[model samples]
Target: MELRQLYYFVKVAKKEHVTQAAEELHVAQSAVSRQIHQLEEELGVKLFVQKGRNLQLTPVGQLFLKRAEAILADLERAVIEIQEFMDPEKGEVRLGFPHSLGISLIPQVVASFRKQHPNVKFRFKQGMFPSLIRDLVKGEIDLAFISPFPREHEQVCGEVLLTEELYAILPPGHELSNRHSIELIELKDETFVLFSEGYSLRPIVYEACQEAGFEPKIGFEGEETDTIRGLVAAGMGVSLLPEMALFYSGTLQPVKVRISAPSVTRTIGLIHRKNEKLPLVAKVFHSFLLRYFLDYNAKREQ
Candidate 1:
């Protein structure tokens, strides 16, 4: 039976009088009577015993009345749960970001989001861009912050979260360390500390140097951001990194460089699959990140 018909049957059972039930439901007495009759016939059971001007519940009607109340209670609760998800102040959110953000930005994003939505719980994961993209498409991740794409992968949507400047980090008192900028050609003779193969920035870093007419002397490669930075600080060699990376890793005292190459930029971003529907929590976190980083950029630009 339709939910509306069930509702009428329930109200009539409660009032035990067709006229009073209709008054409470704001429906005409005849409409309420007709709806109950339809529900009883649809259920193939006689739900009421009729006397002069009042009704009593049949055995079947007593059982059904209880079930109907429960159904309506569940329906009411479903509506409330949906509204909570839409409210932004209550929902479960899952976020994935690169290790760089895991250290610097995600904590602040979590703390701030929690202050407003104390009830919402969050799950955070850190992975490289390729791995995070796979998780997003596979439905294992709701939202991601990642490095810029190496190639346009299928079925993924992305927005640049922040454009960060790259700096050439070097040991204290190194000859070129005090300079505001350095040309790639000037470093041709120097050994370079590079991130190990498969790190997202490798190709871009190498290619930028090639365009500047030199292939860097790769002396060492590292797996962790801090390890690479420490190698640079220890006077082992110099390296290049996005400014956002530097903020989380104070392993080295870094130097700012006016990188004089066309491909001398870095982007951290929000990513999700194109056809994926974000859980309400993920959407809130995504929007908050966009605003948080935008606010950061505004202040930095000023």
Candidate 2:
């Protein structure tokens, strides 16, 4: 019923031990027990049952825990919103980005933003495409840098910052590596290395190949950009990689061949909840990215 009681119950539920939760909350074990008992009595349900030395949430308790956690998260966001509204320049931005952007795009934007607004802080989380969109809809993140940006989702909306081309990554001694640019159909017969399923890039590559009239023979599947690149470098198979992932130094690098005919590409952009108002800091960073990339594209044109 009380905020303190909810807080105590949630913490204890997660840790599954009153003593540990008390230690974390910097309170005595008895105080935590008293709060949990009061919360259960008010709710008229047995929240937890004892199993050996640890406590486990009952079926009803598991359901209550989800609601309690959501309430806590909402309250935390409300506090952050008010604090950020008071001092937008010094507030924190919770931003998500895919692994491909971490090397270049993300750092570029963050560095430029901080130069003008040094006090503004950033908390970054790197995720795959689906998880990025999932977190955006769930309110876990304020804004996300996503690729092949979602267009028709109901809960979230995205804006395209820039669309970059995807290139054919070939092994060192492949027969067609000497070509300046090759068509998608040229690689149709070649074995391909691709990102594992659930990655957005895999489908792009698959569809591009399909559009070119051949189902690519996937030779290997990898989770990371560098892993696919490494597989290609080892002559395992060729792959289609975004421009960002191709930046690497020293040896052990795959040959990057441009995809010309039926060109492969993906759009990079930011996504946020459609109807909810963003915290002031998130809005500030969001606007900064749009302008920064505007100049970036203009410079690229000239």
Task: Write candidate 2's Cα lDDT for 1-302 as tens digits.
Answer: 79999999999999999999999999999999999999888999999999999999999999999999999999999997678666779788989998888877788889888999999888888889889988888878999998878888888886899988899999998898888999989988889999899888999999999999999999899989989999999999999999888888868888999988897889988889999888887888888888888998899789
Q: Give the per-residue lDDT digits (tens) of candidate 1, residues 3-34.
A: 89988888899889999999999999999989
TM-score of 2: 0.73
lDDT of each: 0.79, 0.90
**Window of ten residues with lowest summed lDDT in model 2:** 79-88
Off by over 4 Å in 1: 1-87, 149-151, 248-256, 261-263
Clashes of each: 0, 0
Q: What's model 2's lDDT at 278?
A: 84
- Among these predictions, the greatest lDDT belongs to 2
Off by over 4 Å in 2: 1-81
